[model samples]
Target chain A: MDVILLQLLNGLDKGSAYALIALGLTLIFGTLGVVNFAHGALFMLGAFCAVTVQRLLSISFETIDPDKVDFLGNPAKVKTPYVESWFGPEMGGAIVDWSVPIAILFAIPIMIAIGFIMERGLIKHFYKRPHADQILVTFGLAIVIQEVIKQFYGANPIPTPAPDAFKGSFDFGVLLGFDPNAVIYPYWRLVYFGFAAIVIAAVFAFLQFTTFGMVVRAGMADRETVGLLGINIDKRFTIMFGIAAAVAGLAGVMYAPINSPNYHMGMDFLVLSFVVVVVGGMGSLPGAVLAGFMLGILESFSSMNVIKSIVPGIDQIIIYLVAIIILLVRPRGLMGRKGVMED
Target chain B: MLGLEKKDTSLLIIVAILTMFAPFILNPFPEGSALAQFNAGYPDLMQRFVIFGIFAIGFNILFGLTGYLSFGHAAFLGIGSYSAVWMFKLLGYNIIPGIVLSVITSGLFALLIGYISLRRSGIYFSILTLAFAQMSFALAYSVLTPLTNGETGLQVYNSDPQYFHSENMPNIPHLFGAKMQGTYSLEMGPWSFDFNTGYYLCAIIMLGMFYLAIRIFRSPFGLMLKAIKTNQTRMNYTGLNPRPYTLAAFVISGMYAGLAGGLMASMDPLAGAERMQWTASGEVVLMTILGGAGTLIGPVLGAGFIKYFENIFSKINDTVLHQWFAFLPDGMENFVITIIHPFVGKGWHLTLGLLFMAVVIFLPGGLVEGGQRITAALRRRAGRSGRSGDDASSTDTTPAE
Candidate 1:
């Protein structure tokens, strides 16, 4: 029971990430009818935003310290960050420690702006083209974005540590009435899950309760009818694109400490998130989230020794196998509507 | 000529002339010169040009004709490589058996994948193929390590059985007695050219495949595939089943990829799982699109263009950049090198990405269309000038078509 619970906890963080990215993909598919292959690059850019924030906060200037002597017998030099000098050491130190969270504030606007530019500049032109062309153009954009990031950050993964306060692991087993050390979950992972839940909820609420979202939903169902009603559905759809980008960006910002931010991390997540979206039924928001978490748990479960013993190397290919079987059996996916991409 | 149309015969002859004289044509730069770094006539790179040309041609047969974009084609290439290497281990280093086995195996594998993947179309088909490819990659990388050799990659060891081995037979891959690596270099006053046995073998095979592709393009079967691309629903309404035609194209292309992979292994006797990665599959798609998909000569041209640029662009570094800009003032040279630094060497992919986007957006028909447009414009100019003279009749007889 403890092992099962532990694996479930383990699955949540990764599942949250998949759900977040798939949600964004489905949103763009639903609204703009564009398959944005570069969506993963957006997730990657969000992580880099955190890296950028940390680097910015840590920019230091050197000053001579007369009281201390160096190893060379000269006066020691102290390097103090601009943040430390401006806000005083304690507050500035706290701010730097919390850079990953601080990045969310910066990433939202930046990611939305990027989404706007991408839609207006590149994706906007591909609306009337074939799906293959849309995929090809966006794929090119993904490669360009990934390469540009690699050029700036080099090819190595950069570790972005979480704030000091959330550094330690929590004893979940004791709370669940199991052995003390059976289910030791990290504090940050719990925080990530909560953050993901809030974001997912907020997006749902925005789409459900707001008049703008209602218009966007109407546009998704029938763009011509919405346009015929004299609603500026295209403009609203673009805003929806921006919101989706922010959601994906937020997912990446929170995920930085879990996995080191790397240039190719986006591509890695991209293939899996795509499978998640397809399995959940394309253009279905609730289906994407549910499928993401389910696949994440299944992936973790398959990686267990018990499962591996039954089917050797099952862990590496379980998701793909499931995806294939699901695709073959349920062509439209779990919640797919009839005639949605049926052609 | 050779059962080909007049235009196709000329195109075939042109391709033949180019491949046959490649060593001379590609090595235009003199040996040990400042521009020598740009030459791509070496045995290894030449072998790749033809091998990839075959791969792209096969891909075009499926994607260009049927408009079914598959993202799992690299899995066939990887399977071909692994089977070829296995053949080398079980039998002798003779490439004939390895190449044959590779085609059969990859064809069977493609039949299986295509049967399932062809059930859907558009993005769903792409994602399905992508999933299968990734699954194959994962399995090859780990679960099937005994067969694939995992991270170390599959290579023939001394202990492996080679039933056809003999003292007189070359240990490395060979055709009868001719070693694949054997090269004859000709050195002139300032020019040098390398004629490699492996390159010639690959070039001949590529030409055979190219001819076959041309035949396929002109056949009634080819028209059906093109019809499927145009409108499958209408074809279905016309009482034609598109499934069998698409599957055949998919399998044939898979065999082409396998042949290329087999040739690759024959040249260098090693098979790695990385060859099956989706990025490698993406490379073939890029080649077809860049050259102009559906055009007869486009895939070969695109393949050669990409491979040649990849070789040349990656070789350039800061020192080479500075040397080229030496005539400029020191500060200006430094500035130029810094500006050009990101688009060369390690940054070659960035340039490739931007180029791909520009091609997709501005020139959807690819380089072939661009060439045709330029020729048409030149003809128009000549026609305009000739209209003022007595030669106007000759100009009017030959329209731009």
Candidate 2:
């Protein structure tokens, strides 16, 4: 029972990421009627945005401190961050420690601008083209974006630490009847889960409550009718694209501390995320979220030692395996609508 | 000749001649010259040109004729490579058996995947293939380590028990006693040409395959595949089963990929999980598109172009850039080098992606279309100066596509 609970938590955290990415994918597919292969690259860029803020916060200068002797018997050159100099040490230290969260504020406008440029410049031209063309162009764009990131950041993964407060594990075992450490989980992962839930909720609320989102929703169902109604539906769809980009970006920003930021990290998640979107049912936001969590939990369970002991390397391929079975059994996916790529 | 139309037969003959004399034609730049670096006349690169040509030609059969965009065809290629390597390990150092086994294994794998994946159409089919390929790649990289050798790649070992081999036989991959890597370079004046055994063998197979592709393209099955591409719903209404036709195309393409993969191992004698990755599959798609998907000779041209750029353009560095731009003013040369630096060397992929985007956007029919347009324009200009301006105008309005 404890093992089950622990795996569920693990699944939720991973599922949170999958849900976030799939939500963005579904939004774009729903609105634009095009598949954006560069969505993962946007996630990668968001993580890099966090790295950028961390670097910016920790910009330091070398100062010779006469009080400290060097190994070579000279005055030691001590490096102090500019943040520490501007603010007092404690405040600046805290600011540097919490750069990942602060990156949310930094990543928003940049991601929005990126989203705007991508939509207006490239994707706009491809709106009426075949889906294969859209896929090919976006795939090319993804490669270009990843290569640019690689050129700047190098090929290696850069470690971005979480805040000091969220560093340790949370003992869920003690809260339950189980012994301590039995259901141990990372606190940041919990934070991530809560954060994902909030984002998903906020997106839903905005779509349900806001006038703009309602118009967008109407456009999604019937673009020609919305256009006939004299709403500038194209602009709204463009904004929705930005929102989707922002969602994917935020997912990447929060995910930085879980996995180190790397140029190819987005591509690693890309195929799996597409599976999530497909399994969730194309263009279905709630379906994407539900399927994300389901797949994630199943993946976590498949990776358990006992399960792996039986199948040897089931963990490496469980997600894909599940996807194949699901696709074969339920051709339209869990929540797919009629005539959504059916032909 | 060869059951092809007169025009296609002539095109086949031209291609055969080109491949036969590629060593001489590709080595036009004299050795030790500044432009020599651009030349791709060596056995390794030439082998790649033909092998990848075969792969792309096969891909075009399915994607071009039937409009089935498979993003996981490299799985078949990877399977073929592993099978060929295993054949070399278990049997003697004969490439014939390895090549045959590779085709059969990949054909079987393709049949299974196509049967399931073809149940769905359009994007769903693409995603299904992608998932299956990724699953295969992950398995090959991890659980199938005994078969695939994990990250180190599958290669021949010193202790391999070759049951059919004698004590004095050459251990490297060979055709009877002839080594696949055997090369004879002939120097004529400033121009040197290489005649490699593996390259000629690969070239002959490619010619055969290209001829086969031409025959397939002109056959009744090919027209049916095209009809399916035009409208599967209509085809269904007309009582034609699109499933079997598509499956056959898929399996045939997979076998071609397997043949290419087998040839790859025969030449190099190693197989890695990376060959099965979706990126490799994407490369074949790019080749097919860049050359012209449905047209004969397009895949070959596309494959050759990409392989040439990948091999030759990537070898260039900032130093070479500087040398190339030395005639410019100092600051201008530096600026030019800086601008060109990122799109070459390790940045070749950036250039490739940009070029691919440009092709998809502007030249949807790929290089074949582009070539046709240019020639048509040129012909129109010539006719305008002469007497047949009206005829030229009529031909210009209707694109060959």
The C-alpha TM-scores of every prediction are: 0.97, 0.97
Tens-place lDDT digits, model 2, residues B1-401: 86777777888889999999999988889999999998999999999999999999999888988888899999999999999999999998889999999999999999999999998877777888999899899899999999999999999997998788877778788899888999999999888999999999999999999999888888899888889888889999998889999999999999999999999999999999999998899999999888888887888999999999999889999888988999999999998888889899999998998888899889988888898889778888988898575542322112123
Error of 2 at A120 (Å): 1.3
Q: Residue B195 in model 1: shift from native, Å?
A: 0.6
Instruction: Give the Å shift of residue A139 in candidate 2.
Output: 0.6
For residues A73-128, write the lDDT of model 2, one tens digit per residue: 99999999999989989999999999999999999899988999999998999988
Which regions in candidate 1 have their CA more than 4 angstroms from the true location? A69-73, B387-401
> By TM-score, how accurate is candidate 1?
0.97
Q: Which one is best on DockQ?
A: 1
iRMSD values, candidates in order:
0.6, 0.9
Error of 2 at B397 (Å): 17
10 residues in a row with least lDDT, candidate 1 chain A = A332-341
- Which residue window of length 10 is worst by lDDT in model 2 chain B? B392-401
- lDDT of model 2, residue B398: 25
* Residue A317 accuracy (lDDT) in model 1: 89
lDDT digits (tens) for residues A1-343 of candidate 1: 9999999999999999999999999999989999989999999999999999999999999999999999999999999999999999999999999999999999999999999989988898999999999999999999999999999999999999999999999999999899999999999999999999999999999999999878888898999999999998888988888888898889999999999999999989999999999999988899899989989999989899998999999989888888888898998887877777888
Each candidate's lDDT (Cα)? 0.92, 0.91
